[model samples]
Target: VVDLEAIADQSYQFVEWTGDNGTIADTTANATTITMNGSYTIRAEFDITTYTLDISSTAVGNVIEPGEGSFEYDDGTMVNLEAVADEGYHFVEWTGDNGTIGDLTANETTVEMLNDYTITAEFEINTYSLTVDSTAGGNVIEPGEGTFEYDDGTMVNLEAAADEGYHFVEWTGDNGTIGDVTANETTVEMLNDYTITAEFEINTYTLDISSTEGGSVVAPGEGSFEYEHGTTVDLEAVADTGYHFVEWTGDNGTIGDVTANETTVEIFEDYTITAEIEEMAAEYYQLTVEVEGNGTVDIDPDQNEYEEGTEVTLTAIPDADWNFGEWTGDHKGEDAEINVTMDEDKNITAVFEEEPTDEYELTIAIEGNGTTEPGEGTHTYENGTAVTVEATPADGWQFSEWTGDVPEGQENETEITITMDMDKVVTANFEEEDTTLFDVGITNYDEEVVKGENVTIEYTVHNPTDKVVTEDIILIIDGERVVVQEDVTLEPGQEVTLEYQWEAEDAGEFTISTDDEDDPDPVTVTVEEEDDGMDMMLIGGIVAVIVIILALIGYMMMKGGEGSETEMEEETEEMEELETDEEEETDEEELDEEDETMEEGSDEEEMEEETEEEEMVDEDIEEEL
Candidate 1:
């Protein structure tokens, strides 16, 4: 048997042995045995080892050359790497170790592999652009008016400056890009490519105010003034002595009150206004006074002539049993005393009449569902006076007659005349008509309602007889006709539902019924005030606050109790410490007493021993003798 072996050096690998003359057991194995049947020769093969190269890239990009995945290359081999990025993306750098990159920033680069290497081509998103512009009256000051570049989510400071006579309004752009649209100086987040504009407006207007020779402008004073557009400016003109202000005339802009010396003007465009004034002329006019009836007229200053624009006071005095009625002629009024302007010739008359000596009372009364003229009350009238009374009946009722002190022939008339020779009482009577053609009954209605809400009353009207009947169905509230369904026709034995809506304007009890006499029962509704939720909420809030306060007090009381307990515990501990100290002192005293007693006992024992020794010495002496 012959043994075969193949050995490989460092960084090299062994391959299968190759030979033609021997019977090898395994030719592919590194160590094997061969039978030596004949003379044979074998050779070992080796090869250089190759390392794995892994190439990859980040998202949105990929390696184009020597593409992705594992690749085997010999040592010291240089591999070209190229990274292609998608739109809106760019190559950033190359990452990973075990390899030498030619250029980290360059998209197309090379990597030399010395061992197993993992190379990653890094990619980054591109930066966006921002373009800013302005209107005619403004200019962007920050990052000055041109296109700017920024990364995503970059907040850029923006500022707009307005020219003279102008004001910055706002910054307008794509929605949600600007931090504050109404501020002149604000910021914008660059989310994407964006275009924004700064808006401004020319707002000021000039107002030139002047006045005629007799007057001068006082308010917003006479010279030229500048005001913002749509500004209301007050204008006042004061006339010199003996001069009168006429009217205000303006070439442009709206004057609130043009005829008044003090007014306001709304400025839109440039405006020029003048306050016209005229000199007052002095003239005198004659005052003529006339008296009618039994009144005497007296004029202040008692002058027959007065200057123009002078106010004269006139007093009217009547004789006994007479009263001043009114004034007539140039000035007409019912005032007993009056002031008249003497601009021209003035003539005024004071008329008076004697008071009536005999006056009577007329009392009016109503019967049934009707109202009378002058109402139901007592009215005063002169003696032998005639009073006319008219009666108007409610729905389903007619005026029947006039009774009580009415003229005999006029008793049957709706309108009657009553002579008030003395204290008299008259009555206007109304009677219900036979207009009930249907058997009406309330079917549905609400008995309780809220104020300011609507209430619906539904009633059914049926024709009970074998005939077609047409009648008016009226809704009455508190004996007054509120609404009427006119000319409702129903066939025999037919029924229909009629509905009436009434707004409950006030909180009260109201009775609702139909005018049909067949409807005997009236539905009464009680309107209640609407419940206020705010009141309940306020009460609940107050209760909650009170409960919170009570809880706080209880907590404080609990804390106080804990503090008291702690104090008591501290006092108990102090007392226990005092007791321990006293016990220690007592033990020390007992030890001192024990030591003194032992010293005394020892002294006694020593004295006895000395006595025994002396006795023994004496005995010895005797024996020696």
Candidate 2:
């Protein structure tokens, strides 16, 4: 905190201190140290009063020529003004265009050229003497030269040359003597209507300034200032060739030596607010800020915010060559974290390891024609519908758990079902030979019967020799087994019925077998219903005889019941009546009826008696003849 008494009433307060120019320094005399972070303040001033006037020079004789050397006061001379500073601090160097041959130390100091390179003087704090007339009352300067036509001196330092009862206003000379001489002006005018009288007074410093880059044996990086009477420290820019320091007097305390040409003094962000009570409107105070140095990066941060037990990937890429370094933050449950390091900077990445997993299948298969010539049959662990392969370890071999796809869960001799869904060319593979075999006959049945009752079905037999043989036979119906008939004897061509009860109720029109249904004799039977009409013919003959017998017996009973013999007697009587009624010579039919009756009766002998009586009588007469 720089508290300069001169600036205690001003809006801006100046801090002070001094240091080597490029090295470092505290800016204010009241400031003690540079805070670890953020802006600082500085105030600057340049004193021009009470400076030196030196003449280390060269002179040449004035000659009347076209191109000659320099002189002054019109003695036909042309000369250069070459002076150096002698008042001992940082000074603004002067050249020929402005005032020359001396130092300038007032608020507006002036050094004029005079008398052909022969006159030079300096102004320090002294008596204020305003004299136009050449008369001295005290330390007031009085003119020593007489017979003055026009004098060129107007005003003197009023405070440095003031007598007891005089505040010198002008330079008054005798009645017509002109005075044009002022202390801090560049050129004097011709004496007009001015007087030259001597008056004097005393005073102190007029304003305030500080020399922060003084040249008082200051090191190459320090800053300071110099003055004639009192002192006020100022901010002077750092110079590379010399040291920089600060000059102060009165009672503006608190300045220190520090590092960094630009140092910032701050706690965190602290600021002071001071105000006076007599306020009509508000006011604001400010300072000019300077960012003085280079090196172009800034990094300041707080705590990290993430999880404590999660795996994450971190990648770092730098603009420089950096080695493997230690981890600063947390690494949850990461496997190779903290234990691993990156030896280089690149687009680097990492991965984690995994564990191994175990799987097993079985199959049953038939190879070859699958009909009369089945070649090989097998049960295997590897063969399946999808053909899964298993690592089947043999009896003495120890099993190794597989890491890839297997047939089953490492089980051996498992039964698997397989079917022939289509006509296929198949091969049965196995790890070892099977102990059992399947017996399927290749014999087929051929039966010859009449066309309405029996159809001719052809068959074949296989694996047979010329002997009485015995084996198990499997007979299949449709696609399943209808019979498994075993143990049979046959004399080659001789055959017997392979009787099978019809378990199937419906007599289906059947394809007795597939071409691959058997390797043996294949049989098929067609049963039929028995005949009716022959018994009807035999019962019809017996019914015809019983009808003929009843008809003959009825004809004899009708003749007896009608009385036909009595009718015959009555007919004989009628014939006699007819003969009686007939004439002897004309009725032949009547006589025939009478003859027929008399033949049936007693007529001829008795009729002859009458004829004899009549003959006796005639005999006597005939005797007379």
Candidate 3:
């Protein structure tokens, strides 16, 4: 019999042992015995071990060349590895078993399978794209027009430039976020694949303004101005001394009002506008004519303004009972009509005087025991003049009528007028006075009066009989004497009116009258009360406060009830815990009592067993004997 063992070195494994002539047992085992007879041979064999290269990758990537999953190869074999990433993702490096890889930082590398090894291709989401552009009027200067590649979450600076006649407007984009959209130079955050553009716009046009020699542009004054398309601009021109503005002329614009000095223009493109002006044909002069008294001057042409060296006629036409006196200032004359040459601005005055007339005499005669106004003497007056003669009666007489050349409508009046066309005489006749007194009545009064406001009451006193009387005019309110006018006298056939102010003090209806026999019906005045808003507001505020206070009290009572219930529940839980603790104490006492009883019974059983053993020993000793 022979014993053979297969031994292996590092990175090597034992194979089946080869034998000839004799039977070999357990040929595949490393340590096995080979049974041999005479002329027998046995051999132990070993071979290089194979290894599994487990190739895998993280998310969004895979191994391409040596595909994913485990690949078997001999030990110390060189394997090719290549990692491919999907769209919007990049391979980072090889992860597991880094020491076996040739370049750990490269996506495509070689790995040596020295033993059973595992390798991983790591990838990450990183890169994105950006596209920038511009409009026709301008161009983007920074991060220029093109599609650009950048890492994810990158802040890119942007800038835009405009041409000479244009301007940069804003930055626009299809995706991603810009810091400032309206700014010419700004930044953008590249979160995903984005396309951005810088926009621009055309500039405004300039308007040139000027004026002619006689006038100057006042509004939107003579200058070069810039405005947007289809803008309306105001134009105004002021004329100088002795010159006037004619019309507005423009090179390229639509004028709203061409004939007016102040107008508007619509501008669509670059334009130049001018104000046209011209001088006047002739110099003007003013003819100012004034009259001293009761007359007016009339011009032949009757125009407000006159040319230089123009003749104007002055006719001083007098009013009734008046005559033209004289002309003063530039032309001085007493003629009724005159001519004046208007050389420059001239001021003239026309003075007029009364015409001469024949003199007449007015004699006032008294027929009774009364005095006439002229004392029964003759008076001289001009023709067509009116002379008033009044006849006042004595204490016991009254004026009846006027006779002898009195005015036609004033025969019954105590005061009469006599026209002095010729020599005239007037007589004031008087007679014995009657015994009747004067009649007094209320004429006009306010029917409605506000409280604390004054009301006017008008009363008239008339003497119908041919007598003069003096009495007090009394004003009464609500059947009581409130105001009195003392010493009011009424002549014969004469009437007088008086007024009184009475202030309303209370709010009610009151009667107003005068204390006279011929007084009219009493006037009832209603006094109104002023509105007092503050008292009503104060009462409403008190009621609102009471309501709010009651609501607060009700809410506090509800909260207090809820608190009592919670406190009762807490006290009940505490009582339950106390009862449970008492039950546990009773259970512990019962356990202690059972333990003491068992200990006492165990002692009695030990005593009984010892007595039985002693009796058995005595019986054994008897058998031995």
Candidate 4:
């Protein structure tokens, strides 16, 4: 018997079987087998019971009902499909290449997917708009002169009217509206975007003019004035014999020229003007100013003379190479110009002189190592003015003389006085002081010495000066001062040597110096550990003796001579060994002697140099004693 079972899952169902099968087998089964018969097998089949539902939009709109994705559903299950319009579009309908839809015109509908299905949601595009505007002085009505957005092939009504003093002329822009309306009202179709404007004309007005009793109106005939809108009208105020025009008032929106008595007015609306009048003032007299130099004079006034109470500004100008000196006559001030009122007839003079011939420039130049007060460079002074220049020397130097354009015969003095009538350069010469008095030098007893040995330091002091001296003499080792001799006098070219012994404790450079006006060059010595040559030679000799003894023993053992006892052979071997070792020792001793001899020779040369140096020191010490 064969067994068979029907398997049904959430997404699939077992439909049937094919090929080999048994009488008791089921057509649909999850696990089944047929009875064995001549190598045969049965095949089971499965059907997808749940199908996927895919939702999508044609434009940027969303699928509101079943969110965009594949959804699971059983066979013949119905899903509600819907689409929402985005900002600039409208949902049209639901469509597909496969699937059964309930409605074709509806945004919300039911879709039955007996098999796999795919569909699209159709949407329609929306419209946009352009705007229009008119400058000041008018108004627009209705669909008016503005932007309007509508669906394709939509009609919009437009109208235009103007403000109080303006009249509509014509409609302009966007191809002159739908109808060629020359009137203020019209209509347009918004097939595409559009911008438009309505033009208008301004109306005219009359301006009236008048003035105070002391003044009269000149331009515009002094009466009611007429002009088209935006036309310019000239206005003038004429003052009578004893009057002056002050200001204008009354409906004068803006004065064309505020500084003059006459001006023009623009008429956009009706207006009236009035001029204020002021009384006349007292009379003034003329004040004449004269100049006596090659220069110019400037005065501030509308006329040659100013009013009695007005203050006039006077300025004096001078040409190059000239300077303003003083203001003479009516004004007693030393200034070049002065302000005065025209109370009476006055005469004044402006005096100027040639600028003082370019002041004399005195320059001091330094030649050597010294500084000059009234320091280097130009110093300005009037003609015949006196300037004193002094030269000061720095340390280790002295001012010797002065030269170059200085006062006659004053070139040899440290300080010189000169009359600066012309530009002059003076040079100050300097010389170094005669400080070479004593020649002092110090040296170490040896160039190279071993640490822990005593090193003798010798200082040589020589009186290189021509004169004799009884002064304190001091010796310095490194930097520490040690007294040598006090109140000792010596003839010219006399020299003395002082000595000090110092222990060499550290291996390094050792220095010796002395204290004198002119200290001589110092000397340096080096200290270090000394090598022991004898110990090395002894070690070498011992090693050679051992090698020789070993070689003798090996030679005797390999000889194999006839009829020899062990004791005698051994004795002979000892003697031969001893001889070889003695010969080696003698050679080693000779090498050692040669090494010592070489070392002694070098030491002897060093001793000779030291002895010579010591003898020279002894002679100098005797002279000091």
Candidate 5:
């Protein structure tokens, strides 16, 4: 025998046995047994039953059922049942192929698969025929689907007119009904659709083993659904009368109440109970789900900002016939006391515990997946570092490339610097050789100053090219441009700081502008009154003169008039010299003040700049110091 216990439907076994008398005989013996599905064969016979039995035997049965997988649908395949015979007592009469209706022959019955096909012994069915019809259209219907609206509080009269001689019998439905019901008539009183069903009472039947009720068993009717397992799924049982239930006995004894039996089982154990007239199953709604995070949330409508740190509470309401479903995500839903994941970058979903819940498509990304509001931001990562990207445009501008010395492969939203070192300018039409500079800070000669002292303007210029800037840059101030005319060689990209001084003149407002508008702008400045320090000195000298005068008076009183006249002449000469020195100082202060307010307003502009070169130099200085 073949060991087929471990195999599924695609396997089988063949075995053989022999008899005594030293004569090799066929496999069939005086007593042999065969079984199929779960029952033993109804009849059996031996090949040779005379005198001494032969010993030789073969495992293959003379007449054997073919293996599965041969029969199919559409471009059809079939199983050929052959009864093998050696020298035998005449082969008996039997149907080889056509086992049921559409059967033609007694010895060889050929099977032609119609819409559906099944194999059965003609000995089983006597001569009965099954006729199916529906009160609504299409007697062959789906579960929990398809129906027509009828007046409420009235029984939906469904006429399942049986075959010619058959009479109406039992009725069934998905949601079992209750009311006055008999074999033919049914009364419905409640709501809910069902897999409405009805059987028939037939006579002159050849067989009772089977009926042509072989389509899909409708589950629920229009507006209805299947119930959860193990729960007492309530039904509007009082809707339709004469509504019965069809019980299915599975291979495994798992239905209602069964004793301990060690047997294997199939998919479902229970069966569908139905009502005669169905009122579609009803679904409940107003399903509410409440959720809360582990932080606080402040909703800013104008900015669309959600500030979360502690916890938040959210209430969700569903459409009619929907109820709050189990929650999915970091937290399980109960009373909404969910301890959210420390980093839940997505919104948790709450669903209805009903059939066919809706679905949505969401985008998932590891970086640059969120928005940074006007004032709010969230930091996320890619390759273990932070990055941010924006979908909206910045208020007054758009984002342009900042191309700086950044690490390679850095993508959008990575924080990097934009170079503002130099500006693009007109490249030709100059008296000197063509040149270029990199990250150079232009000079601004016009600045506010005080006229009482010499005013100094300092700027750093650079030749960032291989050529030299031979043009003497005339530093213009108040319309008086001063040309350096100094001959100098500036190496490639060489930088130099220049400082210029102007002597004091008449006091007046003067506009100090850059001599070259084609260059960068200049700085605006104020020149206040100069601090000459002469007032304090003059005051001190007057005090000294008073003291000297008093001292001379005292000396005259003590020594009479000796040398008094000589002292007076000396004092007069000293006073004259003091006056002359004071005049010169006053003139210098006045001239410096006048120089500051020169009143000439050339095209004045103020420029401010910060340089990376300055920073690099500072770094070098620190290293040196």
Candidate 6:
């Protein structure tokens, strides 16, 4: 068992034990006992002084902590209380109290409950509603529509935004102390509620233009009208009939290049724009040029129209085979280049007359001793002019042929006609005729004869025509007249030989020719030294004896008789003739063998002559030494 005792102080007293222990000796005792069957504590109970704490709030708030109605605590015990305001209110202050409190105005406070006390927490309203509105074209941006409540000294931001084609102007109605009154967005300290509106207006501007009397302004319609501010309008000026654009005038709003037909203008304010034009006038005169006579006219700076008093240089261009003639009609000069002034409409004719038919030089040339009737000189004639030219042979010459630009059929004619269309050279060729009465020729005494031998020189005359010709034929040998026939009449196609025999006394080269000038050409002959070893007289005598014997034998063979005995004699004669023939063949064989020795002897003589010449040269060398 345990025992407890109660002790009391001046301000506190021990309270009774309120526990479920084993047992209490006294039911309301300050001193108590508990049976300790296992373990127990005995609590002492005492009755001391205590108080009740009553906390209350004003109409819009409540005491939240420490219970709302009352709180019981022993004397000198501490109690903490809190007061909270309702939706639109705020806590003010604590009014009644019988204990010590921490603060009166604070939402939360502490007090010492020494006795039963009652305290009332006072609260006041601290909120204001904010109302926002705007004009029909715009609305508020922040803390936007409807009512809004805020605490005292709370900051509220208001912004107004305008719709398209409109702008914000100002704010109105129940507005608090605004931060920026002129700005679309502003702020306010909400000590009280606010209701505000944003005003807006539409944007616009003015445009004005005009045109002159001669032409009408096509673009912008020449009027004073309104346009949206800061807008770029296209401005143009179009010319009417017989007029053109000059420039634009007035207004500070400038267009690109005032004289241009199309331009632009920026409208910021009212402006008066004018498009000025000028009247049209003709500035150029007409000029016309014509050509004639197979030619063309070329003009410098050629055009259909030319400025008044302008001079155009005209040149006459002629075709091939033509020439520039005089210039007539509006230009009166023979010069190829002429100038015409364009004072009025000009009609000029470049008179290019046909040039005089081109004349070419026809040259007549004579060849081989001849002359021409047209003369041997270059002569000029018009184109296609017929010229007659005749060729005549001089003296013993006759016209043979023509050459060099002679017509085909007239080439052989002594007379011909030529056209002088172009430059030409003609040659009249001639040849000598056969007018010689007789053909006389002379031959040398011998082709090759030895000195001191008899040589016969022959002269031949021929008459090759159908008639008889009479002439004196003279033959010349070695430049001397050796034979002549005076008054020799040769019948047609007759040939006569007149010969002269003489002893060649010298060894030399000789020429033989006729005395006729037409047959002056000649032949040559050579005479050599005679061979002394030959016996001509003896050989001649032997040949004569042989010829006589052969003649007698031939006579015997020709005789004939009339009997059998005569036949026998004839047979015997035939036998004798055969014998004679055999003997002649033997003699001819002997002669041929002897002739070979003659050629051998001649060769030896030539070798001896060469040896003699060499010896002579050696002697000469010795004498010189």
Question: RMSD of each candidate?
Answer: 42.0, 58.4, 42.9, 26.8, 38.9, 45.1
- Clashes per candidate, residues 3 or more apart or on different chains: 0, 96, 3, 1, 54, 5
Each prediction's whole-model lDDT (CA): 0.79, 0.31, 0.76, 0.70, 0.36, 0.73
The lDDT leader among the candidates is 1
TM-score of 3: 0.31
| Cα lDDT tens digits for candidate 4, 414-479 | 888998767788899898775535666764367677776667777666887788855655665556
lDDT of 6 by residue, 236-280 (tens): 787665567888888834566777767887766677888888876
Model 5 lDDT tens row, 1-625: 1111211121212233432312323333433433333422232221311121111112222433342223443312333433332331222333333443243323233443332343322221112112223443223231122454432233454344455444555565542453433445444433443445555543231100111132212322223233322323222212222222233332223333222111111222233332223333322222122333222222222122233322344444445554455556544664423443212233455554333323321121222222222113222222223222223333323333223232345333324322222221111111222222322333554445565646666666666667765444455556675654244457677877777666545455554444464546645445566555534544554454455445545645665555568865764565455445445544644453355443323101100111232233345334423
Q: Which tens-of-lDDT digit does each residue in 1-625 have in candidate 1?
A: 8888888886777877787625888887878888888777778878887889888899989999899999998777888888999876889998887248888888888887678888888998878889999999879999889899997678899989998667898887763788888888889887789888999998988999999999899998888999987788998999876688999876733998888889899887899999999998887899888988997988996786898778899999999988898998999999888998777898889999877559988989888998988888999998878888888999879989888888878888887877776788888888988767677778898788778767878888899989999887777786787645778899999999888777788899998877754557888999998666433433443354345335444644565655566655654464455445434444543453334224445435544543454344345334423
Rank list by TM-score: 1, 3, 6, 4, 5, 2
TM-score of each: 0.37, 0.17, 0.31, 0.26, 0.22, 0.28
Q: Give the poorly placed runs of model 1, Cα more than 4 Å off.
A: 1-166, 169-213, 216-227, 232-241, 246-264, 269-274, 283-296, 300-306, 325-625
Q: Candidate 6: list runs displaced more than 4 Å.
A: 1-29, 32-203, 280-303, 306-625
Which candidate achieves the best TM-score against the true structure? Answer: 1
- Clashing residue pairs for model 1: none
Give candidate 6's total backbone clashes. Answer: 5
Which ranges of candidate 2 are over 4 A from the true structure?
1-461, 464-471, 478-480, 487-508, 518-527, 534-625
Candidate 4 residue-wise lDDT at 503: 66
lDDT of 3 by residue, 235-341 (tens): 88998766788888877348888889988887767888889999876778888877677767787877888886678887888888887877888887778788877
